[model samples]
Structure formats: C-alpha cells, structure tokens
Target: MNIEKRVAELVDEKIAEINRPDVFLVSAKLHSNGKLIILIDGDKGVGIDECVQISRYVGFKLEEEDVIKTAYNLEVSSPGIDTPLVQPRQYTKNIGRNLSIKMADGSKREGTLRDATEDAVIIEEKIKEKGKKAEIVESTIPLEQISETKVLISFK
Candidate 1:
C-alpha cells in the first residue's frame, strides 16, 4: 500500500490499542521530503501528552514493521484553532462558539453555533436595519453547502 495510507492505518491501530475512544485521527500525510505529519483530534481537546504518545507509538510501529526503510520524521499533533472544521464531531464539540463559515456559493456567515448534527448546523446571528434595533436570527445550514468553517477566537 501507499505510505500515507499505511501511516494512517498504523495511527488507527495505535488509537485502538490505547483505547482512546475520545481521540480520532484527522489526517495522516507523508510529505515528499520524508516528513510524516499526523493530525489527531478529540471530543474535548487533545493534549501534548496525547500527541507525544501517539507519535511514539506510530514511530515505533513503523520502525518495527519496516514500513519506511528510509529516514523519516514523525509528528503527531492536534489541529490548531485556526484550522477549519472538517468533521461533524468537531462541530459538536464547538457548540456555543462563534464560527465563520464560507458557503459553496461564495457567501459568508459569522454567528454563534447553536447546534450541530450529521446533516446540518444551526447558528444564531443578529440582524440590524438602518433605523431599527438589532434582531436575533437563527439559520440552519446544510453541511453540503458549507465550503469551510473556522471557529472564531475572541480576544475580548
């Protein structure tokens, strides 16, 4: 099999062996320069210790199985806050947080995420007219219509 697929399988195996049901593999990529990047996420959040544990386990397994005969660097970590939401679980975990969404039709929306499911997400937003008080509005967006979604960080 291909190197990236093999690495992903090893990561899945390690997660199962360690019984980390909360943790899930986001992606595994073997770059051209022999860099193996593994991104993992959790229902809550992934810690540095979890990343180190997975990194070590996957690295050792790769060596033991001789998956990559040449020298390769292994890195395992959580997708950072700036990364876009790619999974339904990720959206569920970020309930009540602000999200900036880009639609497939080139529209954009920013609001507080109220609910999320397999099919769609509900967001609460505010609408203001020229001379009227702001009105609260909630919208349901289908998952298929969303091109990207990023959790908005407030420094306030």
Candidate 2:
C-alpha cells in the first residue's frame, strides 16, 4: 500500500478512541519544498504530551508495518482563526465577529460580520461626518471577491 493510504489507516486507528470525529489528515506533497506535509486538524483538547504520544504510537505502528523508514515533518496544530479562509465553513466559524476582508480591487473592508454562509456575507457599517447624522449601510458580498479573510481579536 502507498504511504498515504497507510498513514490514513493508521490515523483512523490512532484517533479511534479519541473524541475527534472531525479530525482529518491532509497529505500534501510539496513540490517547491520537496517534503511531505501532513496537516492534522482536530480539537482533541489533549495536551502536547498526549499528542506526541499519539505520533510516537503511529510511528511505532508504521515501523512495525514497515511502511516508512525515513523521518518526515509532522505538523500538529489547532486551526487558528487567522488562517486564510478556504471554504464557507471556515467563514461560518467567525460569524458575529469582526473581519477584515481584502477585495480584488486592492481595497480592504473592515466591519462587524453579521452572518456568512456558503456563498456570501452580510457586513454592517455606519458612516458619519461632522454636523451629519450617521448613515448605516449593509453590504452583501459574494465569496468570489474575498481575496483574504482574517478574524479580529478583541482585547476588551
């Protein structure tokens, strides 16, 4: 069996008892970097030591199976809020939160995101000037125009 298939099977078995049905592994063959990147995403709520134990266990299993011998980089991480938005689901996580979206036209819009779904989002804003009342505007944006997306962390 190929390494990818073997790794998947091993991961499935390793995380079987762990309460992380959402965990997934992405096997990426980096052409530029010339390395195999295994991206692990899941909220296991386990400490770093536990995660390392899992990796070691997987390594032992793979070694026993003689699937791989050389060492490669294994990146275990919790998906961060600032990760560039890839799918609608990513945007869904940041709903009711502040966002800064870069548009194709080189202009960036910052607002409180009201809602976001598979294809679009609602942005609420207000414009005001001296001696003039504030004018509130709502903008609906399609996902295509979003060049990048990031979550706004509030310190207050």
Candidate 3:
C-alpha cells in the first residue's frame, strides 16, 4: 500500500484513541544536512513534548524495531500554513478554506479551495492579470504532481 496512506491510517487511529479527530499527522524527514524537519500541523495544544510522547507511543504500536535502519528525530505539529498538498482527503477535511499549491512545472497558485477528491482540487480565485472579479477555477492535480501544500489562514 502507499506509505502515506498507511501513515495517515496510523495517525488517524492514534488520534481517535485520544479523541482528537482534529488531529493530523506531521512527520519529520532527515536530509543530508544533518537536520530534521517535521511536516506536521502544530496546533490544538500539541507541543514538542507532546510530539515526543506521541512518537514513542506510535513507535510502540508500530513495533518495527527490527527493520528501522537509521537514527531519526521526532516532531509533532499542525499542518500549519505551508505544508505539502498531499491526499485529497487532506483538502476535503479543510473545505471552504484557502491553500497554496505549487504545480509540477514550478508554477504556484493560491486561492480559496472549493473542494477536493482523491484525484483533484477545485478552487475559487480572482484572476490577478485582469479583473479582480472572483472566478472559480478547478484544476485536477494527481497526487504525484503536488510538490507542497499549505493552509491559507485568513486574518479576521
């Protein structure tokens, strides 16, 4: 199965156990720079300490002690304003909101999200080159094409 799907399932199950459906999973990746960066939604009172606790707890559940091959860091946080634009389920969970997307060809688009599916996302936006009038534009992006995604926060 897809690694991300499996991870999401694991995270969802764990969050459910804690009764935090609002909970989302963010993971950290180790790069050649010797730094660890986690892709998580840092919100809902979850802190670094809490992230460690959850990581240990999840690792206990995974029990993959025999296969894991390298030292890794753990970080738990919210999906924040700029995370990867991944599964459609992620978008649907945040419908009627705004997000920024980078296309496969290095194009960036930002607009209010209308909806999402496992395959595509529909957005409502205003064309910047011409009229400021709002327009609804739907672009279908395969999961493979997404480089990154971030939640758009509106300042009231």
Candidate achieving higher lDDT, 1 or 2: 1
What TM-score goes with each of the models? 0.87, 0.60, 0.58
Candidate scoring better on TM-score of 1 and 3: 1
Q: Tens-digit lDDT track for model 3 on 1-156?
A: 333355455566666777755556656444554333444442243556545656666555545632234454434454555556455557777777887877778988887888777777777765655757666666555656767778877889
- Relative to the true structure, candidate 3 reaches a TM of 0.58
Ranking by lDDT: 1, 2, 3
Best by lDDT: 1
- Model-by-model lDDT, in order? 0.90, 0.65, 0.60
Best candidate (score: TM-score): 1
Q: For residue 14, give model 3's deviation from the true position in Å.
A: 4.6
Shift in Å, residue 49, candidate 2: 9.6
- The per-residue C-alpha lDDT of model 2 at residue 39 equals 41
Measured by C-alpha RMSD in angstroms, how accurate is candidate 1? 2.0
Of the two candidates 2 and 3, the one with more favorable lDDT, higher being better, is: 2
Candidate 1: where are CA atoms >4 Å away?
Answer: 128-133
The lDDT of model 2 is: 0.65
